[model samples]
Target chain A: MSDEIAILGAGMHPWGKWGHNFVQYGVAAAREALADAGVPWQDIKFVSGGATIRCGYPGFVAGATFAQALGWQGAEVNTSYAACASGSQALAAARNKILSGECDVALVVGADTTPKGFLAPAGGYRPEDPDWVRFYLGITNPTYFALYARRRIDLYGDTLEDFAAVKVKNSLVGSKNPRARYRKCFTAEDVAASAMVADPLRLMDICATSDGGAALIVSSLEYARKLGKPNAPRVAAISTVTPTFASGVLEMPDIATDSAAASGVEAHAYRSMIPLKAYEEAGIGPEDISLAEVYDLSTALELDWIEDLQLAPRGESAGLLRAGDTALGGKIPVNVSGGLACFGEAVPAQALSQICELTWQLRGEAGDRQVEGAQVGITANQGLFGHGSSVIVKK
Target chain B: MSAKPLAPAIEGWHTMQVKPHLIGSQCTECGTYFFPKQNDYCRNPHCNSTNFREVELSRTGKVWSYTNACYKPPAPFVAADPFVPYAIAGVQLETEQMVILGQVIEGLTVDDLKVGMPMELVLEALHETDDDIKVTWKWQPLTQ
Candidate 1:
């Protein structure tokens, strides 16, 4: 009678610039997930794919493309795209199907082959497009990350050392992760020595874009019980919410914040709002969370997410980092799969990759990166524009 | 070719004044402002009023935050040769109560500004097209 659905299995293709076709990675991860779930491809009643804009035409129609690539079995297909939140949205779609009595089992997959260096906007004098506008203004992706990272310094007295420490901690833990792309431990000096892309953020302070894939097999609780997965981890909540009006934080791809000049309307922090709904639906507070996976697009961003997740007090996340509370075996450890710090970003495949780490940790299969007795885990990410998501999983 | 005329980069986003103001549209009913001027509709969640009036945004604001770009951006950015790094600021306009982002005037860096510092808009050469110098609005520290 629970509203939660079962996470039957999780799998991933090692994240890196392998440079093969994205579909090949998707098939590999999908087959691995099916094998992990012990569910036949034909038994998958639904194919929910996180869409990739980089993979050419096939990426746009990802659900059917993946379905066809896996050998079509007449399964219902759905594809969801919300920039970086694509995987969470795809998982939300699968969860909806199961909870709505539409399907028993679903395969959720995402993969990408990204271009090296800065993800540039398309050409031409299109000033109307926000992406184009920002780029035209010399506001590259690191510009946004740097602004946020700089704010931490101005507001909280955070220092470059604290920022470097985040990279150091994530790199150390991520080194243990076989699936992580950058397993080499990064030191504060290494971070400081890197080229400065944006002030207060060195090249090491920012995450890289890499090619990778990840997948999950989710089923209705009833189907899980029938399959003898009664003890499997459950998808307790998924929140893919758009920002309320007057988004004050100046999200990426925008030239300005929503004007709060209108009387009686207020500017809202989009990142903080993403996880509140997930907590409400899961019937739990931050205290119940054992670990978290957040989008650390930049190292300082990990501190921002820790606060947004309410794991640490506002302006106190760096203190938590200093005290080791956010490291493995520490209180409410975050990004134990090394996070984007180690994995880099695979875009569509990245969010589900967080869920995969949670599934493994909850099942006590996380190897050395496991948080002891993890009962609940949360993942939070802010996609471009108005899209963002936070998902909660429980054992 | 050097005598080619200078023009607004994207056209009409800002004026050519020494103390320039970015052009935006305010929802007539809600008084909510939008940069690049949203003339089609209003975005105030409480009101669905479609009427909007083009208005000049506040000329000065406080720096909500700031940073600098150290690498050359890809076109259509049209960076200068040698790619001198330039500071960028997120200035919070008092009347609009919205933060607007723009590049800082040439030769300034993050070291030159801080959160809550006052800033004003100015016209600057964004990039030079073969046809003309494409200009854009940039933020300038009032202290400068």
Candidate 2:
């Protein structure tokens, strides 16, 4: 296990439609994390924050904004924006600082209050922007999710019933998570009865837009040992990779995929590379992961992530789910914190929340949803504009 | 006013013809193709050649996958007054070995689409204002 940088504490503001400022949620989560770590705000040497674009000026300079809100003590600050992977990028920035001895203690926070309905592109008419072009062509995120879902159905013989099962499973575990937005267990019937936001994807199959925050406190292992926390869980590795040349799969916001005519495609799908890089950096394989938290914007996507993470062989995620291997008590339980299905997506906060869940699981502090004897965990997600991230944490 | 001279929602994207085709860029050195036309450099990491030529993509392809929007998308996606959900398809062009996404023709729905079915490109109205009708390329499954 790598002990380069220790995760001293992890915390989050309960996710819901709380209708508060993003800064307020971020500050609350930050305070909770600092208290949990037993670190004074003034002791933190640096702060790295994830930006939420919808908010005005403060959103752009979130690191300084959060530091000011927490009463700045002249801590060095930085901010990162990678859409859904923003939090992971922020954590990566903090981890690098701690490991390099540039900062003894670092705080990483991400928070967002997502606007309701389809996430629109930043207001503009720049014809050069692919996001604007896709929007004008009426391609929403769910539409892309549906295309993938339909392809899976045709290629792998997956059924709508199988997709509903994912929601049912995640909701059951989500109901046990007090911080999750949706606390009620959903049956397959409930999922089937929900309205279809995009064909082949029902309301329950898709996660909601929510408001929330998540934060983490990290320090060098030496500092962690000096602080009387000799056994703190540590961030083993973080992967923030972009797509390979001529990536064959169609990703979000882009109307087309890279051409495969020149650089012939790889045997594995593009998304799988994200976690593979993390596994390499951690010197661990898929078999070493006891649990995982993956981006599940839609039910079909959870299955896609399963294959991408190599939890199961290609085209076998549905079989794994049907066999109960991905449930709370099964081999390699995924998304024990209810996932996006229950928490909804708070954008910048979502990826950090995944890390928090993994931290809790590794430390054996997850009350009801704990994966027994969990030692190593991984969090995997993709962001708009070709950003992909995966983080590995170990107890 | 001559039906407002139907204009493409974005220029340099598709040809204004009865049977429309997407315009893409081809790397002269590596033979790679790019939609929405990459002019900066050859995207193939192995090839650093910057030379490119504009080419019209194949008008016919096969459906890689398809889905329909059941809810009205948010702006700047223009929708009909009553907001009729529309089907979209990802078509794998036979020549370039790339998949491009576009809305299906007006009469087609998700029910009419199946993977690997042959499809052809056509031009259709995306949305209209009092003065002009914005057009975009769409996919239509060819009758077997």
Candidate 3:
């Protein structure tokens, strides 16, 4: 019951393409976080940064890079690269530092100035890399999303209308989010009229990549008391885990799977386990979650997360949508922050920014889209190459 | 790129190396199994244990889904040619309540694949690079 870390400050550099360096966005967000925390930059004891794939450098050392941008005060620094989960991982690293007494107060930042057009492979196309294979095979991210969407249709008997409903829900919420990249509400008819990005999936269904940054300042309970804000929002868990190799189901960004001839470990398919692990670590189950902020990389994915997160029975997510079980007034409000559908995917900054939304929702700061009487909130997101996942539970 | 026939990894084949076989996870909890084994941890939300054992997948499974690559794959994928059509599919395991994806072996055109058609897993020797023979796994419809 005593396991709690204070979320002293939360900040963002908005979510859009402004043609600025990623470090600038991160530093700006971090500075706002420090300011929000009512603490000086020199008072921060540690810095953790979520990584971004950068030119020349395989990974942008956000921790040290942002540290330098903010002027080094000799703070302990760390960097994490779990794709979209990078933000949560950065927050986790900072949390551990505070929990372990390695640091009393920490700064966590995530930012990305993504490339224009389709998120192509980083330069050279290596056939061995799944990311490259999917691209070269002409299997765009939308295509994989389509596969899952199609599967839902075939196996779960979902309809294209169900998919459109997802867009309608998230867009409605996103329209109210000032930090969201896409602020316009969309109707199911609008979704039906959109161009097809992949078979059965329209352009409106998929989330676009953008440039944005988000930051959070976390401190120990004692540190929060010293700052005069005795009651602060907390981060319960950060689940950035990988899939098991079993039957080696081919995940996105991968062509062939691990040969059953090799390691022989039973694969823990992510769709089923990833969210559960975070809930387990938080000592709460789906029934206890009051609200959720999930990675809706695609509209269909939001429905998938509904089942995967056990918000609804398997294959019943679409029905839940039709019945308004997941809407703002439903049993569990998901992605009340507008989600990726309206916010767009800002890659490295996505998952971390998701937690920022959770912080706001849990603290009853979400004005229009807030879940009524919200007590606990969760954030779910997955990144490429077994890189990211974050499930933050806050009350 | 030349059409080099895919060779099995078994002995007496044109290429060397044990056929790369598809692998997956078998649950001790409910007898459920999966390909691309869930090694990180047991996934069954109903089960709490992460204890999982690696098992060689069934050599044969039914075709659950199929698709064709109409364009050249990116670097690292062994494609020196452009617009070469290749067939791939999701194969359903008999024992595992899961489906695995792989390229259909050479000579087996997409026309030869059908959903629910029985297929067998095979190790396709990808390419010979000096001392190492890179191999991968594929699925082929069983001869009726």
Which predicted model would earn the best DockQ? 1
The lowest-lDDT stretch of 10 consecutive residues in candidate 3 chain A is: A256-265
Best by TM-score: 1
C-alpha RMSD in Å of predicted model 1 compared with the true structure = 1.2
Of 1 and 3, the candidate ranking higher by lDDT: 1
lDDT of candidate 2 over A1-395, digit per residue (tens): 44358989988999999888999999999999999899999999999999999988999999999999999799999999998999999999998887777889999999998776667776767778888888888888888889989988999999999999999999999999999999999999999999987789998898889999999999998889999998998888899888776677788888988888874554334478789889998989999999999999999999999999999998999999999999999998989999999999999998999999998898899999999999999999879755679999998
Runs with alpha carbons beyond 4 Å of true place in candidate 3: A122-128, A245-248, A258-267, B1-60, B65-88, B93-143
Give the poorly placed runs of model 1, Cα more than 4 Å off. Answer: B1-3
lDDT of candidate 1 over B53-100, digit per residue (tens): 989999899998889988898876888888889999999999999999
lDDT of 1 by residue, A46-158 (tens): 99998999879999988898999999889999999988999999999999899999999999999999987677888988978999999988998888888899999999999
Tens-place lDDT per residue, model 3, B68-140, is 5544444444563444555677777665545666667776665686667898766664554445554566788
Candidates ranked by lDDT: 1, 2, 3
What lDDT does the true structure give each of the candidates?
A: 0.91, 0.89, 0.73
Docking class of 2: medium
TM-score of chain B of each: 0.94, 0.95, 0.76
Interface RMSD of each: 0.9, 1.3, 7.0
At residue A169, give the lDDT of candidate 2: 92
Docking class of 3: incorrect
